[model samples]
Target chain A: MSMRRAEKQLARVTGLILLALVLGGCVNATVDEMTYNEPVAGIGESSVVILGRRHKPDYDTEFDFIECIGDHIHSGDPSIEVINEIAFINQFYPWFEPRTAPLQPQTIDQLLQLPPVAARFDEIKLEYMIWIDGNTENTESTGSMSCGIGPGVAGCFGFGTWGTESEYEATIWDFTDKVEVGRVSAQTSGQNYMPAVVVPIPIIAPVQGTACDSLGDQLLEYLSAHH
Target chain B: MLCFTLLAAGCSTKQVVVEGNFPKPLLDPLPITLGVIYPSAFAEHEFFDEAKGRAESDWLVKTGEAQVEFWDILFDGMFDEVVHIRDWETVQRRAAEIDGVLIPAIGDLQYTIPTHTNVKIYEIWMRYEFRLVDIAAIHQQEDGALSFNPDEHLAAWPITAYGKTPTAFLQTDEEAVNLAAVVALRDAGAHFVTSFGATPDIAVWLDGIARREQDAALSSSDDASGPQPIAQSSETSSSVEREPDSGGTL
Candidate 1:
């Protein structure tokens, strides 16, 4: 090929490669799904309330996970009642902190004896109450990330990968039985890669959704099978 | 390294509170069963950035749980009598359990640490918003009784504390932010103690009872020619009230 034609071919190839990298970098995804429950029947007409344990600096991503569970449950069984955390928790948000553990079975039992289902999540009959607790953390770290202008180099630079772990668990109870029923937990880990360059590109592995969905699906399956 | 350091430093959790022991309640320690609903915990507030002319969030964060604990402790120290923390929903569902409710919101939680070397001053401030609502009126409303039109039934106040420190340039700005919180909480608590009034219904109802007693005594004296009852001034009789419209703090 002539010099100009060869240069054009190289430009096309570079464009295709850059496009592929952009698309691949966009997917900083992680997931881990698990469940431990046998399905039962005669749970219809009863309601389920899903709650999450609250944390410092609550992220909007939390709602995404919760809504996903609610959505999946409805799709599985429209008749079954699913109360979102916000409607119940925010209604009394001052009192019922979100994502926190529910009152102990003893406390719940006493309150229910005096007045059935004192959680007051809703005025209806609730059989299943699910409490969720989880958070994300950096499991390990290596190398360093820095941004500076020295000699001929400028902008940002980093040459290392940082591992992040997302851990979560859900504890379920049958208030009707006034006993502990089941607990589901999930964890996912991945590394965020950063290559030294003029403009640093750090691939982040946001596992909040992954962990939430994995547990959500399992929780729904358990609820579905039991119902 | 500098940018990473800054980000790491910026991400933190802090509890803002009055440093020293809370002062004694001055006004006979009106010991009504007080409860706070959804009191702010340590977290970023968007308003802090709004005040600082920034659009980003997480710039100002607070440990709201600290505030909740501080309020619990401050009341324990300030009040000579019990100040119970009623379950938020129980109080809402059964309004009679609580004497009054304080829903608190916070602002200006972040410290302003200028990034540039030329800017030498760093400042921090916090604002507390208390929405004080009367329990009786809420009960009345819940009972389908005619509701008062924002009259003596509700009052809101904003309390703020400010602090300043020379640009640290290199040292952590946490010190300055914390100092500001201490000052803010102290000042805010004092203001709350002196200004927070009983629910409007209680104040108004009590005021009516006092006035009737005074009038009856005056009439009885006028008829029997009894020694004229000592003149009772309105300010001295009804000083417990802090209603804003009548030349009072709103």
Candidate 2:
């Protein structure tokens, strides 16, 4: 009876500890948007292409983050269509490559003057082109945990934490009108904790996911408003 | 024996072979039949980097197959007709029929990982040297037979390309290295297609070809058709100038 009572107490304590770990990590996020021009009317059938800017030497906008935003926009509104980034890039190979891609809205106009490019552009009927830039990075880390093994017993004991920050900007251009439509940006930061008694339990902060959510919400609203 | 095998496994060198597919470029093929010579050394390129520390492993990267594939796709898209030359003898025999011969070789290659650069990415850099042989000059020898000069080339230029992939997403170092190499190859192809005619020597050679073709047409035309103008397509007539800015922007 004494042994049974001890086992029950251990089970109750483990449940409470797991509950605390589940709710430990926290993140803070903010989103900002600006409109330079309204979306063109009667262009709902065309698709939008979201591309990540990779020209920066030190960092690149993660491809998964771009896909997350694209997915959010499509899921939020079933009518809106999103083209695969790789397909669109490959179809226009060298023209849209890092070295040759146009920098300004006017340069896009020059590209469309080519018959082959113009034909492909018309076939796709691209409504809007969104360029995403930025990255997520670990900002700070502190504390450490150590593990040891001896005589058939191994365990870790300590507390540790780390912080991550994500910043990103999305620029939207109206391909039909050949003009800038608007911009949306999101910034987020979070702290993650790992506390160990016997086994280390990690509570990972959703830093990138939060940023993607904020940016995607704003973009969806902006694109769907006119429709 | 098992202990010895484990020790050997721990010290085994890492090997990576690059492979990728490239799409055909969206542009009008230039109006010229070109001959391309791929040297044997270029077709089987391999780079070996020894580990500088005990913590790192040696690497042997082979990019020969990928190089050949990339060049084949790029040449097919850039020229009207591509004739592969097996050797200089083939070039000598066919020099009169071809507009020019282009020879490409790997100049140098280097790579870095996160462990070495303290950056969270894997990067590869490649230098390519291109030689454009003036077939017209070679075919116009005073003797009936063609003369060859190893030191003579109408244009020789170097192009540099770079590629990098973040280490965060890749699961293994070999995968990261392979990706970086493929990306570098694509960059080189894009640069060449965009800047081929913009090089100074190439521009002069193109002008000479246009003049020669125009003169030949004028001579062959009947008196009634008198001094026929060279028919140049809009795409062919436009001059592609090299961008002054380096690295990508916007």
Candidate 3:
């Protein structure tokens, strides 16, 4: 009986080890794998389509800025041509609702029908698409001390605390080949805001504006100079 | 037992992520000037006769008024940055003083009958082009073309709407084009400077110059990379001649 009990204990330990290994594999699989190809250089007339799933507050503001910049380009240069302006009417992603939505398949098909959309873009056109997901949820902790004792006495006891901050992830895909080219995941804490302010702050505000502005400026300049 | 094992295994997985950063180029502030290039023709359609008194009458009375108003608003917004040149001659004179030239060309302008209005109305469509000429290279580097069709309609009820007087329409078109020009110039100029500084070949050249200068500072060195030689040669070889401008007002 003693030997049997020892064997049973060993089996339980082995089973636990195997379970842990499998779970570890599962966790590792969740990490995203991003890759990019070499940059191509050439000069030719190209057309671009800016499509989005839905109009959110942030997106609307972004589009307004984009349109303003685009107007500048159009008014200034004759070689650069704008083909079409289209938008999708669907809310595909619920988790990041209002912030991001999935582009309707029909919209994509319709855009493909336009001659300018695919006329020059045989294999090399750059299709820019953005997907924003997740929300900021966080928790924190502190330490406390109390007096306790054995039997009839009390002794001092210290408490420890821990917490987590909410995080969100954004993925940008190049639809020319229907593959994700870049992904950025960021986390914001309550401490990021002003100490006295009660309002929650968005961590992406600075990044979004800065990245868009920089990229837009660069691309426009390149097109202007080259075209 | 299984749950405990799974949790333990999950904690052991380690992933190493790698990231790369682009090289940063040193930026030096240098004084730069830009010129303007104007297109010769102003008419959108070939059918319109320039000599005919009534050729532009209908357009000027209806869409032109709206355009003038648009230009006024645009100019008011950019009063601080842009220097308003009255005509092409002034633009050319100013262009000679600048390092580069931004020539805005009006590609198309039209007014279509409004479809939604209960009464007669018009929708103005304006398209313009911007071209940046690198004076030093004597080459056109960048061009951007865009159009705007403001959906707002002017009510036909007012007698001033059809007024043939220049006051009713001249400023509106000018304002819209000028506003568009200012934005285009600012964006294009910023882009050009950034790109020129960031180019790899240019960066290497600039770095070599910097390194040579640094060496000269530390040691008694003669002209190594020919520091002031290139600048002097270019300046002395070129004559500052103003080009003739013939484009009309926006």
Candidate 4:
């Protein structure tokens, strides 16, 4: 190979290394978990339903996540019946105004009094109910960068980074025992880099999806664990 | 900055809750049907910032709901019905039934600088006015309604308490205020309870003026023949319409 070609190759490799170094270290993800009650054998025969907290408006946007979690639970234990969200809304929630439809019982007494929710519990022979609520927020941001390949030499434009944090917690409620079974919490946060000259290059992490994945796995383990 | 004056410290508000520390047992079951009138405005202090000229923290409008709660909890068995006066018209109309009214006010307040550093201090002076007015004794206005005369029968008590948090206390300025207020209010409340009943000088006067009337026996009562029906056992709430202020008046 000619020395000119060799030098060009070396320059490209060094530029790539420099670009890698330019991106500062991203934050690591963290998680916390807690289990409240001892596991019992009867959950295997009982059906389950996942309900988003009523107060938060964003829970409506998490239908896909609910389905994803339901799929994972069903895959983990095929016999465990997972109620469909659409069916729940149509058949059960129709009894009350849109505002009053709540699957997660505030109190055992409230559950007994709510005819529609009680009837649905009887219909599905529900055992465990999972209440999910969480939020993803951009907590902090810093640094700006602009880089590009101008002619043969790489030039810079502007570079910057911002942090994104995802936090989710799922609580399992047992109807038979009239108690909270356990809780699974997951959180993921990292900073992503964006550089632009003519075009912008971004390295964004799937923070929300990653949290959902961790929570789903943890919920499976919590439900299936012996004690 | 000229804009940041000594009043600037009064801008911020820190919520402080003083837990009960009353060790005095009820001296006597007075059973006085008392109505609580929380203060309209306690003392307010404008605190200074780092510059000692900028007013960064100020005690603004505060609610006396907590005071009502404290009074009820502290003097639980002492009064027959510890009603919080919400509707002044209604409470005043039924005022004839109440034996006395308790009014609480914050008198004075002072704070030190640099809670994060050395030489931090907090102090509060609280005053309570307990008026045991006899409706029949007070004079009537031109409209024929009974006029409340403060001179009729009133007891005023002033209490001063201090909390000092040195640099070693390891608390923020806001935290120092909270901690200091907690200590001061708790001490003031406990002191009030003791002085209201336990003190011989005050108890003798209070006992002579106020006495709970026992329910007379119904002629057809199953146990009416007995000496008297136990008024203490009666769970019936007072017929007096009790209420609280609508907004944060105190």
The per-prediction CA RMSD against the true structure, in angstroms, equals 15.3, 8.3, 27.9, 15.3
lDDT by residue (tens digit), candidate 2, A1-227: 99998688557546645654765557899888996665544347888999988888988888899899999998987677888888888999888777787766668988887788999998988888999989999877876678987788999866677888999999998887877888899999988777777898878889999999999988888777543
Report how large a share of the reference interface contacts model 4 reproduces: 0.00
* Candidate 3 C-alpha lDDT tens digits along A1-227: 99998678557544544443343222101223233441244224554333322232111222333444345445555555533332221111111112222343224444445343344335434344444343222245443434543576644433322332333344545555565555544443322111111121111113233333333443344445443
Pairs in clash, predicted candidate 2: none
Give the TM-score between model 4's chain B and the true chain B. Answer: 0.56
Alpha-carbon shift of residue A47 in model 3 (angstroms): 33
lDDT of 3 by residue, B126-164 (tens): 454444333332222123221111111111010011111
Cα lDDT tens digits for candidate 4, A1-227: 69998577557544643563565344455667787664545366667877654333222225556777787777876766788764554344222212333444456556456554566568778777787777666657765554655456775545556787877778888778777767887778876766554455666656767777677777776666432
> Whose TM-score is greatest here?
2
Give the DockQ of candidate 2.
0.59
Task: Report, for every candidate in turn, its global Cα lDDT versus the true structure.
Answer: 0.52, 0.79, 0.34, 0.53
Question: Which prediction has more favorable TM-score, 3 or 4?
Answer: 4
Q: What is the lDDT of candidate 4?
A: 0.53
DockQ for every model, please: 0.01, 0.59, 0.02, 0.01
lDDT of 4 by residue, B111-220 (tens): 55453233323433344444443322233344433234454344545555443332323565555555445444444554554456654544654664444332242332
lDDT of 3 at A93: 10
**lDDT (Cα, 0-100) at A170 in candidate 3:** 40
What ordering of candidates by TM-score runs from best to worst?
A: 2, 1, 4, 3
Q: Candidate 3 at B224: error in angstroms?
A: 12
Best by DockQ: 2
Q: On a 0 to 100 scale, what is the lDDT of residue A108 in model 1?
A: 64
